[model samples]
Target: AQTVTQSQPEMSVQEAETVTLSCTYDTSESDYYLFWYKQPPSRQMILVIRQEAYKQQNATENRFSVNFQKAAKSFSLKISDSQLGDAAMYFCAYVGVGQFYFGTGTSLTVIP
Candidate 1:
């Protein structure tokens, strides 16, 4: 079984600043995929970044980057230059053996 955990239920960052959301997962599968998704009030899930377990390098998409520690099963997201639009509910997800698991989520607020 695989599960994702996000310790912080809510986070706040100043506009144009940076914020990091923490996530950890437990999985027995050797090969899998980890992802961070952002969902706004519209309830649309947007892919922020993804990382392959076999890959040693972390994944990055524009201002969104991940610090993936495969050995420790930690996949945290770093959001740089935060903007108003970045305020949303962030979910950490794990996909292994056709099974998908998502964290409870972390609500992010961008303060101007």
Candidate 2:
């Protein structure tokens, strides 16, 4: 069994600044995938970034990037030039075989 854990229940970032959200997971399997998903007030899940266990380079997309430490089982999300639209609930997830697990979620608030 695998589980994702998010230590931060809530986070706040200023507009145009940068913020990092932490996530950690426990799993026995060596092969799997990690992902960060954002859910806005509208309640739609958006994939922020994904990292494969076998990949050494972290995944990045525009203003979003992930710090994936496979050895420590840590995956963090960094948001650059934070915008008001970035405010949402962020989840850390793990997928392997036929199972998927998600963290409780961290609510992010962006201050302009």
Which candidate has the highest lDDT of all? 2
Please report, in order, the local distance difference test score of every candidate based on alpha carbons: 0.94, 0.95
What's the TM-score of each model vs. the native? 0.98, 0.98
Candidate 1, lDDT over the whole model: 0.94
What is the TM-score of candidate 2? 0.98
Worst lDDT run of 10 residues, candidate 2, spans 92-101
lDDT of 1 at 27: 85
Poorly placed runs, candidate 2 (over 4 Å): none
Task: Report the lDDT of model 1 for residue 37.
Answer: 92
In order of listing, the candidates' clash counts read 0, 0
Off by over 4 Å in 1: none
